[model samples]
Target: MSGVVEGLEGRVFTVLGAAGFVGQRVVSRLRAAGAEVFAPARGDPALWTRPLGHVVYAAGLTADYLVRPFDTVEAHVGLLARVLKEAQWESLVYLSSTRLYDSLGAVDAHEALPLRLDPGQPRHLYDLSKALGESLCHTQGQGRARVARLACVYEGAQDADGFLPSLLRQVMAAGAQPGAPRPAIEVPSSPSFERDYVHVSDVVEGLVHLALRGQHTIYNLASGENTSNASLFDGLGRRWACELRATLPAGPSEAPRIRIDRMREEFGWRPKGLHSVLDAMKETCP
Candidate 1:
């Protein structure tokens, strides 16, 4: 433990959703830090998850993610139940969403803010399922679980789950070349709606820190900054050295802004800002 980070040297960790964007990053970080990470293949827990040192449950699905919600919810719930029942590790980090937080118009929210979305809200089937899964983990892992309730994480490559891709499509559409009509860029999001957007790297840092600390704490893992789509497009334009503009639509959907005080206090995780994201997009764009 002298050279390697403490509490992780030679440890066996299990990561659900290892193929996912976030799960893959978490697994890589764990492997780099000298932890043997196990990933349950296709929701099968019995295949490769026996001596678990830590568990990072990052598996999720949605309309944008895949085909449907109900098709994936059972597998997730079953996998979670199995993990809780067989958590040989001292600690577990469940990846819950900030969507459960109230859609507080423009209010800043914290971990203490009660999740206002009814456990049975039917608007988004995915949100409802996530709430149920979180409830299960919270109940079973009362004192042993470290629930890392995360916000939007932008790698800036091609994740359509958030506002980035849609906004990018709009801007690109705005530049639709000669002869080709430039589709309208919706004005409502010209100033991107403010959401707790965190970079995936910082998210990994927070998750890794929580996994090893054994604090049994639930923390809000966010960017700790207020950001809008307008700022994002401006940054992208600078990165590409081209004018990026969009039409501001009326009354964009706004989610609660989560405060990341607990993340900073616990793991010292400060997310990369909009400029960093733009730079990432620049490098990633072909």
Candidate 2:
């Protein structure tokens, strides 16, 4: 609840994918909290060697995973396997995603919900690879690994490609042209589709809490509320005078919400909502 990594000072933490979005945030927090953090350059086996006190495996792909399945597998599974096999760490936290629940057809599901990733569908590689990574941490770490199934994390001002980021970029672009007509954000699917979103900072806090004192092997780090594209874009309109250029066929789509009770009950962690995200965008707009 204090937003500080407990006992962060005088600890050595090794973070993989330290150049990435989440990894960068984690490393920044570690340094700010006075932890001895090691972030090796990604993809070099030799650089991975470090005296680890706690490990955070934050490497993997998202939108490009389908095009680069082999690389995705290597990052999500192979690298983690290599680390678990070699590292002597006090505790490890494996960063996973709530997308693993996509195929399960359950809304607001908990960690106990069963998951199935169809192998025939090549697109499922992302989800399957992440699931395999979670399995590796749970099994190999031997009670030392804690897995955080993060929701859609957006830093608001980053160049990353995701629903909220795309909207944030469009809004910021519109603000550049004074007196211009409201910019339109294209929606690729049913506007009714919704999902949970969490800020990167909140996720970092939860990750730190899990790494330091968590007893559970798996936890869902999310905002605990579903926001539909229609509702979210409408809210954006209020802030930036934007419009939705929806281009998908009208039909049903998966709406993914998740329960964060476990994360709250276990670690006293909760996410800051979209309003806070908007406030951050106003301050950090590029």
Candidate 3:
């Protein structure tokens, strides 16, 4: 993967959710590339202060968005609106999710898919908020914004609330003591269920490329591979040499994967596979 280049040198960047998992990685990458960065943590003194030259809107929720609907809207749409209106930015990158493509029945959801979301559904708030955010970026940015619909970004324990992280943590903990009694890693959903997992570092790479040099306004940053839960556990079991038992319950069908050709062709970037993510986590495990 290409490291951040001198193209970003001397450029000023304002990351809204600077403290977040993705935001932090982005800030680190930008600063490492010699760009001046303003990263405000949640509720910090510089929440929305300093002018934003190149803005990366990495602020948003996932698991907690449903519980806090109003907060979700505020973070996803409200703050984004404020940035678009108040901030002085040359280019903006709005971090969106592949979850927005859930309602579309296509096996491979593309950017051109016409989204038809039912607002009456309680769970649709997350989708609705993101949809609105994308709208704001497209209409408000006036061709200066890039909308990145990220896949399930796996960052190990940093993203513990997510499915892959939770499962990885449980399996690793259970395998920590070899030859000892290990607890079953309980998966809330079925093992056969598949998902698209992109490494956080790869997501940051894609985001940075999009923010700096992408031509298309909308793109999907993903590994372009559909991996099942069973496959993930098998990957873990092969490395740990422990009997990994996961209790999985039958759940709803899986959502379709998103296309990444736009990202590949436009940005000339390809994300690493899920197995690479698993290997990285194992090497980092203490």
How many backbone clashes does every candidate have? 8, 0, 0
- What is candidate 3's lDDT per residue for 123-175, written digit by digit as tens? 89998999999999889987899899988887776574687777666676667
For candidate 2, lDDT tens digit of each residue in 92-130? 899999988888664667998888789898888888899
Q: What is the TM-score (0 to 1) of candidate 2?
A: 0.91
Stretches of candidate 2 off by over 4 Å are 1-3, 43-50, 175-185, 279-286
Estimated TM-score for each candidate = 0.80, 0.91, 0.89
Better of 2 and 3 by lDDT: 2
Which residue pairs does candidate 1 place in steric collision?
A: 186-247, 187-247, 187-248, 187-249, 188-248, 188-249, 192-229, 192-230
Per lDDT, the best of the predicted structures is 2
Candidate 3 clash pair list: none
Report lDDT (Cα) of residue 261, candidate 1: 73
RMSD of 2: 2.4
Give the TM-score (vs. native) of candidate 3.
Answer: 0.89
Task: Give the best candidate by TM-score.
Answer: 2
Clashing pairs for model 2 are: none
Regions of model 1 farther than 4 Å from truth: 1-7, 43-49, 64-67, 119-121, 158-162, 165-192, 214-216, 280-286
